[model samples]
Target chain A: MGALNREQKDMEEQSAKHKVVHYPQKKNKVKRNESLKSNAIAWAFLFPFMLLYVWFMLYPIIQGFFTSLTTGSFGMAREFSGLDNYVRLLSDQAFWQSLWNTVYFVLISTPTIVIFGLILALIVNAKLKGTTFLRSAFFMPYMLSISVMASIWVFILQPYTGFLNAILGQLGVSEEIFWLGNEHLAWISILVATLWWTLGFNMVLFLAGLQDISEEMYEAADIDGASAWAKFWHITLPSLKGVVTLVVILQSVASFKLFGQPWLMTGGGPGDATRPLVQYIYELGFIQWDPGYASAVSYVLFGVMAIFAAIQYKLLVKKEG
Target chain B: MSKKLNIKTVVYVFLILVTLVSALPFYMMIINATRDTKDILMGFTFLPGSALLENYRTMMEYVNIWNGFKNSLIVSVLVTVLSGYFSALTAFGFAVYNFKGKQPLFIFMLLMMMVPGQLGLIGFYELNRFIGTLDTFIPLIVPAIASPFVVFFLRQYLASTLHPSLLEAARIDGAGELKIFHTVALPIMMPAVATMSIFTFIGSWNNYIVPLVVLFSPEKFTVPVLMGFLKGSQVAQNLGSMYIGIAISVVPIMVAFLFFSKYIISSISAGSIKG
Candidate 1:
């Protein structure tokens, strides 16, 4: 009887050990299941957006590529024209001219926008009294629609009785500049208007970047007897490298996609001088009713943009190896 | 040492001058709006004039300005709300989920964000036409709802700020997933929601191309499209009322920005600078 009782106690002890060993495993299994369930729920939430993106953006992008290859005959039939449209685009004077115009606008407007933006940023970052009001004032233009800015500037830049010419007159300059009538002057006018309209955005971006720099960096430089110029060059410039790269890339992309300003301000110009590639594509597609040709032009623009974006990514976004 | 003070003064002067240059066009727009048509044509007006009431009347009479404002407001509000929710949901998914193809999908979203707006214009127009949504506001609102920038922005916010452990804790408490999202995740995402709302609002309010192509009727035109039509029409040639129209279009956005400049500035800084 004693031996049987001892054996029963040993079995009971072994059973208790087994329960302890299996308890955490069961809990872990339950946890793993719960995680899987949560993941499923997450995917369910994401599903709708995935469908929308695929249908709206991805599908259209793919269709655009295919449409570029076809002679789109009002959606009735697609004649496969292999590389024909691309070949024709090579000799298209309007395309080349518009491309050149876009490049010119980028060259003129980008640096001006960047420099002006940085200046505004520096001022706002100083946290002077009434800086909030000034910041709001500086950013107000960016809020205005491009169309409104174009219209307002149109009035301002009017040649005969325009405000700009009137100001020039007051300064003893009798010459009435055809701001939007002359080819070169029209481009310049558009550039000036664009610079005013867009400077706010870049300013905000630069301000944001500037604020990210630790105040300690400036204090440290001050302790070293650094001049403001020295501090700006040594500290501010280097700290802003990332943001500057971002601004350059963003501004470049924006400049490359120039459409509304030129379209509204110059109507593609005083003889096509201010017409950018997108505007050309727009006129081709809507105004001219040549979707096939327009599609081709758009693809070429995309190719150029892609190349620019690629180079920008390569230079600006290269991760350390 | 005094030379440094002189240089600092010069720099301040230079900054003020540039600020004046920046402020010039806006000043001109206001001045021209207050001037008579004759004064506008005669040249720049530096002083305030008495044409504000008259110009406002003329502008109101000339264009369906109220309708345009209403349309812009409706469209912008809808875009802000819908896009914000959708973006937050998608961001939540990308942040919390360990699903198949998650990394690839997120990368694709990032890639799509880089594509220029004009790239899809023709295709998007044709798609709208095919979907029988041409000449409607759906074309404007729907596509914008799927903004890649918003998705990318929200995703970054979610991944960095939202704690997965909180989600797990909720799950362990037997809270349903949707409930967890609503109860747990959303309140914490206010900053992101605010940021995206501003961006989407600005984009929708300023949209021209899609609306220009889609909405043919003048009554349906948003502010930008109406402004475009106004600029193209004979009424747009009237220097006085045109400036007034420009002012009317610009004022609302300025007002909104004035109220929310802090949020706007902070959000822009956080999104771009941090990224």
Candidate 2:
């Protein structure tokens, strides 16, 4: 992308130069030296970030691929067992369940979050008296750390004494719902906490997108006596295309990395039902001390995220185009 | 007109009710933090209970909040500063300097934004172990120096705000490249940096998984790790300490949000939209 962008500029610079009088070779040499000096300075600034990036992130990623091929654990000598870990994962029921669990989360959470975000954005964006209260009330949860949020939700969702069950009882839910004890309820608990903790961010994003839309379009619609739904469909929805794409992509990528809420809330189950792919990798690598197999599992997740990201990029670029 | 007024009233009521769902957990937490384990079990209460000091005492006994607080502060502050500054410098390098391979390098870094950090978790752990920094905070704070998202955001910020003519003027006035970046450019990027810093601080302060994996020592655990410990040990037998622990972890962020949320909210949108 960068190369193509710069290539056009380079051609423009050359064509503009072609129309100029020829400069002396010595002057060109001095310009080259000046460019070198700037390059040195640019590199000087870039060195620290690049060094850490390579060491902590880039190198480890490449090494992770190689590590996946072996049966070695952390810092141990490896016996070269090619594709063994990958083959094991093929038959691993837990791994497959975790994968599906993560996908289920993304699929369910993404649209709901986006739609909820849009609704909240519309409400708060209106000239309402409770705008400040509404905005902060919705977004405050997003600021809490996952452990903190998860802890609060656990308090709210525990089987017998949970705040949520108590509230449900007030609304005539006589049975004490085992929110975090039953498998389905456990997943629901994770989803509810996640939705509360995260919806605020998407709301803010959609709010921004909605706010950017010029009021002139809406005013025109108003003069034409357009209904509210019609105005929303024609002006609001179309104008929000960019932010919607961004929110979808960012939210899905984030949801795919789900670990903390489920991990802390139900401890990854009523039995592996809510265990996300990331937590599974953590258990394999840290608990079981099988770094090789863990890395193999991680690569599969990485590939999935990369594909989503690729589609997101395509959507973003299409919008830009 | 009456029907329209009724519909508007319905929308207002609906919004406030939705706000209740979001805010109720927080209110319940604060209220219950004052209640005993027995009171918490009986039912949710509308009022505070008398166990506030007792819960605090209980939490202090189980988890070392001081150690967790200090460790989290150190990690978050260091990560925020390092990431905010270096990311700006890297973005500046890309925005202003015309160099060989700069475009390709910047593009490579852009692609890096999409790569999940979890992809390299095992490798990072083993790599850190190989280097003998396994349990230290080195693995936790060092990697944040290369935040691709911040670099990407600030690069876009700079491209629009920073003009090449300013650099030419700085050079004409005898400022060196580094000095120009520091004096002329840094101030201009300060707002973006400050915005990114808040986000970085909140993220690192709340980061759980990396610390859980990298640091094994109980004393070195951050708040999230310690909170997990608190829950695992006490939620079944006594949740008073767990409630106190949650309050301790969440209240600071809630307080910070109350104080500076407008800035945080504005910054959140600022990065997404073109200036």
Candidate 3:
């Protein structure tokens, strides 16, 4: 992207200096010297950021990988046990449970959030009254922090005094259900909370994609006496294909990092039923003080996300090409 | 025409239903904030109650949520400022300068952006421990300077909108490179900077896990961490106070979001497409 920009910039500069073409050799020397000079200057500007980036971003990655191969906690001397952490993780029950939980969340929540977002976007994008209100209403929950969202959900989902139960009681339900105490119910609650909290973001993305689809296409479709379903099926769906792919990939990547909601809502339980891979890494690295094993699990997560990222990058590049 | 009108009516009804579902929790939160624990326990009510001061007093007795607010504000403001200025600087460098290894460096940053943030959590914790920066805001604040996604967005914004001829004109008029960046480019990029800054501030404000892991002190805890603390503490027993505490964290941002909803929504839209 940067190289393309620079090439275009060079072309612009050359065209702008069209009348001064007689000094080509001198210009080339000056340009070479200027390139070297600009390199230093650019580095100067980039230096402050690079310093912090390397320390925090780059170093931690390398350090995390190194720590994974060792056997110790932070602030202590370590012994190198080559690939032992990885080998152990291969058969680790808790690790597998957490991995499955995270993937399950990605599987369930990603599609729901993306599809619902598309529906919301379409609803708001309709030629109707009160869309501004509709848009804000849909997106407002997204503005709150995860903790707040979890608190509200927990308040509603808790057994006896919970809001949902109260509503159910008015409708003559007898038994008081423990929403977060049962394993399956707890996952459902987390999924519901996750969807409500994040669906707005995907909605906005789809709205953008919807707006980009030209009116002329729809008008032409209408001229052909296409029904609303026919127009949506043939034009709207195809036009939104890119954004849907982008949202799906992004949502899945996000869902894979699930922690805060379940961590707060159920503390990853009814017996670790909702413990995401991230919460597992947190438990091992922080609570248990086993930095080596935690770092190993972190790498596994990085590996999983890298697959999604690679696909996203390939699609983005293809679109650009 | 009647059929079309019927479809529109159905669509409107569906939209209203979604709107109510979306806003239901918030309505309950507000109503519950004014109700005492006993009242909340009795059942949910739509009417306002008279325990607002009592709830505030109870919550304040347990936790200084205002302190958490202050800590969160300080950290988020600094993170936003550092991320915006430094990202713009880095983006300007990449956008304008024909530097050696620039392509590789930019690509490296892009790849790093794709790396899940949790990948570095353990090592970052260790690094902070090693450097004795754990329990300090340095771990949270300093990392904002190298925000790759912000830089990527800003560079893309600059690539299309910024003209090299403008920089050349500034140079001919005796402006230094840095001066031109500040005086010329920065102003042009302010809209984008402001757009990105909203996300940065919100991201920092809502960051939970990092602060939970790094900061141990109650007074230094950010809003999200404090919310967790509130859940675990005695405050959770008093449902009204707990609702009020959560509301205190949410309502201000909710109002701000409403005020800037159009801009914020547009920025999200633009961000996804550009991103």
Candidate 4:
């Protein structure tokens, strides 16, 4: 019998056995009836989330893949030119440049966040006076939205009236530096904003990791006459290996979605020097009205991020092995 | 002993200095909001200036930020309440029920969490358009009701905390199924739910790109979107107004952060470990 028919038959048998076999029968029959009720109850509760998830997330993902294979802009009749969008993406310079810019950002910002986060965690995680206030201070910036972060940085990095240059002016520097206008400096501005805005979460992760380390280890190191750096290098580093790896992977994933800050701060300006791939996708789809090509570019980003998660999972498995 | 003291001193001093660096811009934002355009452009001033009311006036004059604030408040609250309640209900289902296909279905949720929010951008935008809900708050608020991360988080919480015996007791007392969830499971799940609510509210409030993509009308815009327009829409040199607008936009979240910061921090840390 087919699976559905078999389940129906089994369920009917259980119900009939419960009815006819009476109170003296095995208790398993009654248990099966209760479990069947729970099954219906579960679906009743889960149905809303499942409905929306299917409608919004799953349907869109499937649609996005289908949309990627088509050749059309918005409002145009979609022509199923199989893999043409992908083939066209292969030679697109804008695609390559945005990809490179995003990768470059991921490369630069991930380390800055990781290294600085570790140091910040170590400092604030110390049993020092007023570190509570210091912890709040370090994390306060992360609470601001992207627009607020971008605006603050812009106000601080503007050529003449910027706070950074004003401070520099008092310190015997006379020239106003256009921090957001230059090609290299714009990336610097983005990295600074990103680092300021996000490093707090990384620090918290490290702090959690640090807190998980046992006090006994510190005493053990002390008895062995280990130095501070020596203890950190030996005990702390090895224990935090998992957290460090998790943080690194998490940071890279966050960095890869580099749309809001760069888009707001630079407008992908000074000749698209700071346009990340996500921004490129937005402009291509929304501005140019090319959803097919945009979905194609998106899949490229999707594939790479999937690989990032896959690599982390592989590392975890290898560690377990 | 002196060497260790020196290292400790260095660490404290360095941390203090860097902490100042972290807070300086937010300080500048708040402080600069009080200064006039010329005073702001003249130089950075640590002291409060006299343009606070004027700047606030100018911000309201052009941006209609109050309207945006109302819209944002509506969207964020609806999204939070809906996502929080629905996510918990779903978690309770998975935690209690042992239906066929449960494992595969849950693995699907885990996979959903792994996929970044932006991956389905094209399809989502198009789907909204296809459904004729383009430019509506429904597009923004409704999808959030099915937040996979929230589901995953709450499920973990429920597994550890929820007891089957409590539900069995509720059933024995003849409480309805939904009533058991509404009263029993929900009350037990309040601490975790409250922590997740703050995050969900903040996420919805601070959301920029989704609203930016979908929203077209000025009145429908969220605060973040308006923050951008307040700067970009400076058909003239009204930079001071923009700063004040941004300062206004930031204060609510900052205050919210200060109020429930410990819970927020614990949630993020727990979220990472769970992920």
List candidate 3 segments past 4 Å from native. Answer: A1-30, A311-321
Q: lDDT tens digits, residues B6-104, model 1?
A: 966786786677668767887788788898887777666579788888888877776878799999999999989988888788877766665556668
**Residue A215: error of model 2 in Å?**
1.0
DockQ of each: 0.47, 0.59, 0.60, 0.53
lDDT of 4: 0.82
Better of 1 and 3 by DockQ: 3
Question: For model 2, what TM-score does chain A reach?
Answer: 0.89
Off by over 4 Å in 1: A1-39, A72-78, A319-321
Please state the error at residue A86 of candidate 3 in Å: 1.1
Q: lDDT rank, highest first?
A: 3, 2, 4, 1
**Evaluation by TM-score, superior candidate among 2 and 4:** 2
Q: Note the residue pairs that clash in candidate 3.
A: none
**In candidate 1, which residue pairs get closer than 3 Å at backbone N, Cα or C atoms, i.e. clash?**
none
How far off is model 2, as Cα RMSD?
3.4
lDDT of each: 0.78, 0.83, 0.87, 0.82
| Cα error of candidate 1 at position A76, Å | 4.9
Question: What fraction of native interface contacts does model 3 preserve?
Answer: 0.69
Candidate rank order under DockQ:
3, 2, 4, 1
Give the better candidate number (1 or 2) by DockQ: 2
Question: Where is the poorest 10-residue window by lDDT in model 3 chain B?
Answer: B94-103
CA displacement after TM-score superposition, residue B89 of candidate 2 (Å): 1.2
